[model samples]
Target: MDSGEKRLNELGYKQELRREMTLFKTFAISFSTMTLFTGIIPLYGSSLLYAGPASLVWGWVVVSFFTWFVGLAMAEICSSFPTTGSLYFWAAHLASPKWGPFASWCCAWLETIGLIAGMGTQAYAGSQTLQSIILLCTGTNKDGGYFAPKWLFLCMYIGLTIIWAVLNTFALEVIAFIDIISMWWQVAGGLVIIIMLPLVALTTQSASYVFTHFEMSPKATGISSKPYAVILSFLVSQYSLYGYDSAAHLTEETKGADKAGPIAILSSINLGSFFQHSETSYDFSYLYDTSNETAGAFVPAQILYDAFHGRYHNSTGAIILLFVIWGSFFFGGLSVTTSAARVVYALSRDKGIPFSSIWRQLHPKHKVPSNAVWLCAAICIILGLPILKVNVVFTAITSICTIGWVGGYAVPIFARMVMAEQKFNAGPFYLGKASRPICLIAFLWICYTCSVFLLPTFYPISWDNFNYAPVALGVGLGLIMLWWLLDARKWFTGPVRNIDNENGKV
Candidate 1:
């Protein structure tokens, strides 16, 4: 057996997943899932609406700094407990025996549901990007543009979900190879936009405007407080930076996972943050420089159309660039589906999911979690169907993406901090003396962001403008606790070991 398989045996799991992914492929999964193009493009105009250019630029710097601490802490824990179950598995092993089961259960459900929600959100955003492309190709937003109805968007979302699920059901090697391609697509495509924008734009914003502009009027963001608006704007950066933990979730299929998994998590953040910071600056600057007719539309696609039209008087350039952005969402959703399926399979392997036997099963030939892939697809589709009419519900559902993911991540880091005296094994990527301090900062940042996410984004809140994130989170947490009290508490004792723990034998 290889060293990875031997490590699995020590963790009491027989090696089942094919460890074909090398370090680059492993990093690709995390980087593609955290696609900066998908994250920044859709939210760029809206983020500028919050606190102008300063929030988009400086908020990223601030959030990225703290997010590095978060990634560092997660990487340290992942280095020690390199498992597909990831956050929850680390929680069970790191926490006290008395609290292990409950802690793991919460983390598992949070992480699992969070990932499904993220997949749905990414696909949904891709569908929206598709609609925006259609609008731009036909005409400008103010002219005879085609505005897709809600039903059309939902259909596109379902179609994308099916495509992602089918792709994820392929063998690990196939998906890992695609992930590498996706990494390049995001990197090269992003570079094209970053370089091409300032070149072709009819005008450009001054440096002072790009860095120092601040707008927090009651008319601008529905709030008058600069501090609150700035805090609310951090969501754009925080949301984009997350889902990097996909590396840890795929460790079972990764060679030299104990080292590769931790490295992927941190590298994804470092690389993604660098590109996003640069791109966000350019995107915001371009938006400001566009004509008032386009900038007032408050949509990135509209800005692109206006920019290209000013120089070339054609929409084809804008159309092609919009497709580039759409590709980011496409590849991003695929990687998220891969990560979500792994989470479901790992939880089911321990009998944590409702239908553990079915979800835990890998394809006989491909060795992929085929059933779990479909399970995620079905859940995301169901979650998405509401967008046909009650569109606000989609916003509410996507809100869980950030809170649930970071909440799951924080649990284990918090557990490790509280249980510092426990017998812990450091992996090759150990942090040495800075571990606890990093964990503390990471945990606190998670807490602060979670709280901020729950607050209302718009003032004078009503049914339409209310931030229902807290409601969605509360209901989900309540159901998990209720299920634990009623059913899972009886038999669910954290992760199940298929192999003997002491002797590493079946």
Candidate 2:
């Protein structure tokens, strides 16, 4: 057996996932999961409505820096204990023995829930982008003929989710290659739009308009003050920066995971931030000149339509850009499904979840977590059903994902920095003396962002417009606590070692 396989055995788990992914492929999976077009394009209009250009541009920079620190901290932990369980494994290993079980249980559920919401949000965006592309091609406005209905969009979302689930059931090498292709597609496709949009436009916004311009729409007027508007606008960038932990979750399937895992996590964030800054800045500039009352509702789509109106035949250029983005979103959902199912499989293997035997099953031929993949897909579809009735469901899902993901990230970093600092054995990718302070900063940043996510997205919040992130998160946590009290605490430990003498190794 190889060293990586030996390490897995020493940790009391057999090597189950196919370890065929090289460093580049590992990084590609995480980068694809953090797809720039999928996150930024869908939410561009909302940011414009709140904080305008200044916040949209600068908030991205600020969030990227803090997000890098968070990724760095997680990368450090991942180097020491590379496992599919990721944050939950880090929490259990880094915390005191007495508190380990509770921490792992909470972290596992938070990460799983966050991943489900993240997957749903990506598919949801792709569905909307597809609908928008159809509208643009048909030359149909809201008042025009043949506009698609919300039910159709919901069907699209569900169909997309199922497609991702099916795609992920393939062999590991196939998915890895798909992710590598997705990485280049995002890089090349993003550069094309960022450069072409400005060059094609007849009139471009000046640097002042792009950097200093600020406006608050009437929809945001009564509900949000200027300062709060800026804070809320950060969501556009913050949401884009998450899901980088897909790297850590795939560690079991990655070669040289102790080193490659950390590199994948940090590199994904850095590369994603680079492309996001370029694409979003240009996108914001384009919005500055073209944003009318109607355009404000779908900023990116309208910007494309306006910029290439007369340049290309039949608005083909705009449709192409939309299709590129739609394809990126589809690939992103596939990567997320892969990551989420691994988390489900890991948790189930530890018997931390109900029906553990079922979810823990690996496909005999493909060597993938087939059942877990479908379960995650089903949950994503159900979570997204609200979009058929309320458009604000997107915002709620975004907030839920942000809060749940950051919460999962924070617990392990907290344990590493404050709970078990001396216990941590730094791997080859160790941060040395800087680990504690960096983790502390990352934890604090997570706390601040989690608070931001809980705030109301709009004012005069009624049942119809209320952000259900808190409610959904609350119910999830309540169930976890109830499960702990009733049953889990009796038999569930942090992790169950399958190999003999495993307890002695720790």
Candidate 3:
């Protein structure tokens, strides 16, 4: 079966995504607000409005520190063996043949699920933004998707997915350029609010709310009594540091991937995390209410709008600004769309995805993965249904979104563990004198984050089905493992055999 993989290497030349993406452009377009990943939509930046700004803010700081350690370790691994398939490639090389296939399979599972969960979470939030903008237009207090008809919200969520699918499927450069445009809007939008909102009546929120330490209600209820309230705050810290590795996953397509790729990933994490620090700091918290209404499971632009327009209910100017904020939110979503295709192409090349045949096909003229791009776009549209039920099981099982991803970080560490015990010289970024100790510490932290992330928001666990977020994550992984043992083992041996270094192909 790998014979075909070999054949793909010598196949005709084709063009799709340009190979010219510079390190700066890649980082700039892909990096997003901390709120975008943690606060708005799915996680609701729980710290900002729920865990109290102080706790949430500090938690993020701790998270960022932890993030640096993890990124540094990954940077070491990535510099040594960069590949578009990301962890799977690393895992395969690090492990022996007997375990290598299993390791690589798990890595692919993690990458796929992480992408699906992350995208679904974001799309759900995007849909809510769409509804919120409409409510703003109608001047109604009805609020977002939770209040809107399920089908309608679903339509919006899926609709945005289609928009992304189509946009991402075709133009990788267009995605990067538009993302660049949106990054400015995101920065400027924040600046606009901080600067402009003050001009009109000092933009009222509550200083006390900003500093308060509160507990989450549902989670406080016996034996499963772990303090998840900590997570509500700390997760902002966790998420702020997440997703920086996405660029490294695309390293094979990047120029000077060996040196620049890992650097880009780390830089994106640092830049994004710093912005979050700025958002959560007391200087900014003073402008926010510690107990500001849970912006629900989906609604960043709405949060932004209410922050700016709520005080000016009667002022047409503030209302107009609210509209502008919504426009920018969509602009932000558009940028996310741009990168979706590349993930497809890269994943396909690794043979980690279904429809591997077509997805591996590059565009005849564009130098991009045409079929892979469309496939991801189509899935985005279909999976968009989850956003409509923002708090439902469909949307709720993502506790493993981070758990699943831990392998990406964990694999290299574990492999380093395996290798160090046996002694093997690795790359420039390889763990040096402190290799074993550093890998051990990073692995422990990854486990800690995974445990809490998997634990349900509710604590004092009653037998009321005991929220299956973690269980679901495990089941998903289990299924992948089962599949690997029974099916993926023999012929699907990752994309390594398909490498076309001689032809400069991934």
Candidate 4:
């Protein structure tokens, strides 16, 4: 066995996954999963409505820096414990022994729910983008035109979710290669939009308009002033910057995981932040000159169509750009499925989920978590069903995802800072003296953002406009606690290491 496999054995687990993913492929999965198009395009209007271009541009910078620190904290722990059950495993081992099981249970469920919600939201957005493309091709705008029914959109969402499940059930090498291609697609696709949009625009706004212009909606239900609005605008960046933990989830299949895993986690955030910053800046620059009604209506799509209509001679160029974003969302769904399935499989292996034996089974021939893949897909479909009743359900799912993921991230970092510091051993990718301050800052930032996500996105508090994140999170946590109190605590210890290597010196 190679050194990585030997290390896994020493850590009390056999190499059940196919360790064929190279460092680049590992990074690719994380990068592709955290696609900017999926987050930025759909939510662009909300950010603009609250804080306008200034916040969208500068807020992302601040959020990215803070997010990088969170990644650093995560990567340090990942280097020491490179496993598929990354967050939960870290929480369990890092917390006090008396509280480790509960901590692990909470972290596991939060990560699982967050990932499932994430998958649902991405697929839902992809479906909407697909519909938009169809509408655009048929010459149908928001005016009296041939708009598709809600059922059709639901069908498209389910179809996309199925596609993700099928792709993940394939050989691990196939998924790895797809991730590599996804990385290129994200970079090249983003560059095309960044360069082409400006070239095609009849007129571009000045730097001052892009950088210094501060506008807010009079009807905004949330924060009103530009200063507070800017802080709230950080939500867009936080949502997009997530899923970088996909690197840690795929650790079992990654070569040189201790170092490679940490690098992938940090690099994904840095690279995604750069691309997102560039794209948002350019889009907002042109959008500043467009009609407020149009900018507020469809955000990125309308902005692109208006800017490039003169150059393309029609809406054809704009449709092509939408297609690029749709493709990125599709790829992102695939990566999300892969990550969520691995987490489910890991959780089940330790008897954390209800049908542990079934969910934990890896396909003997392909070495993929086939059962968990389907389970993840099914849950995503159910989670997305509410979108049929209320389109804003997508927004609610987005909030739940942000809260769950940020909470999952925070638990381990809190433990590392408060409980594990004295006994913590530095891994190959240690942060040295800077670790404590970084963890503290990351923990605080997570708390702040999580609070932001819970607030209603729109004012007046109508049922349709209300954010259901708290409801979803509460129900999920309630069920987990019920299960724990009823039976889990009696039998469940934290992670059940498969092997018993005395002193880990095998």
Q: After superposition on all CA atoms, what RMSD does each candidate show versus the true structure?
A: 2.7, 3.0, 5.9, 3.0
Full-model lDDT for every candidate = 0.81, 0.81, 0.56, 0.80
lDDT of 1: 0.81
CA deviation > 4 Å runs, candidate 3: 1-17, 33-50, 142-147, 193-226, 277-311, 315-344, 386-390, 393-400, 421-431, 459-468, 499-506
Score residue 314 of candidate 3 by CA lDDT.
43
lDDT of 2 at 334: 89
What local lDDT score does residue 169 receive in model 3, on the 0 to 100 scale?
53
- Per-residue CA lDDT of model 2 for 305-402, tens digit only, reads 76677455356788899899888998899899999999999999998888999999999999999999999999999998888777678878878877
**Poorest lDDT segment (10 consecutive residues) of candidate 1:** 289-298
* Cα RMSD, model 2: 3.0
C-alpha RMSD between model 4 and the true structure: 3.0
Per-residue error for 399 in candidate 4, Å, reads 0.6
TM-scores of the candidates in the order shown: 0.94, 0.94, 0.79, 0.94
Q: Could you give me the TM-score of model 2 versus the true structure?
A: 0.94
1-506 per-residue lDDT for model 3 (tens digits): 12212222333222233556667656655564222334322243334443445566567667777777777777777676655556666777677777777777766667666565555555666665565555545554533313356788888767766676666555566666766666566666656655555345334445465355453333322222225456655764564456666666556555665666677778876765654432312222322332333233333433444444555554355445544555454554454444445555666766767777788887676666667656655665665554444444332534544565554577766776667445443544565777667777777788788766655443445544255666666677788778777887876775446445475765
lDDT of 4 by residue, 257-376 (tens): 988999999999888888654333344433433233232324556656776666665778888888888888888889989999999999998999988999999888898999999999
Which candidate should be chosen as best, given TM-score against the real structure?
1
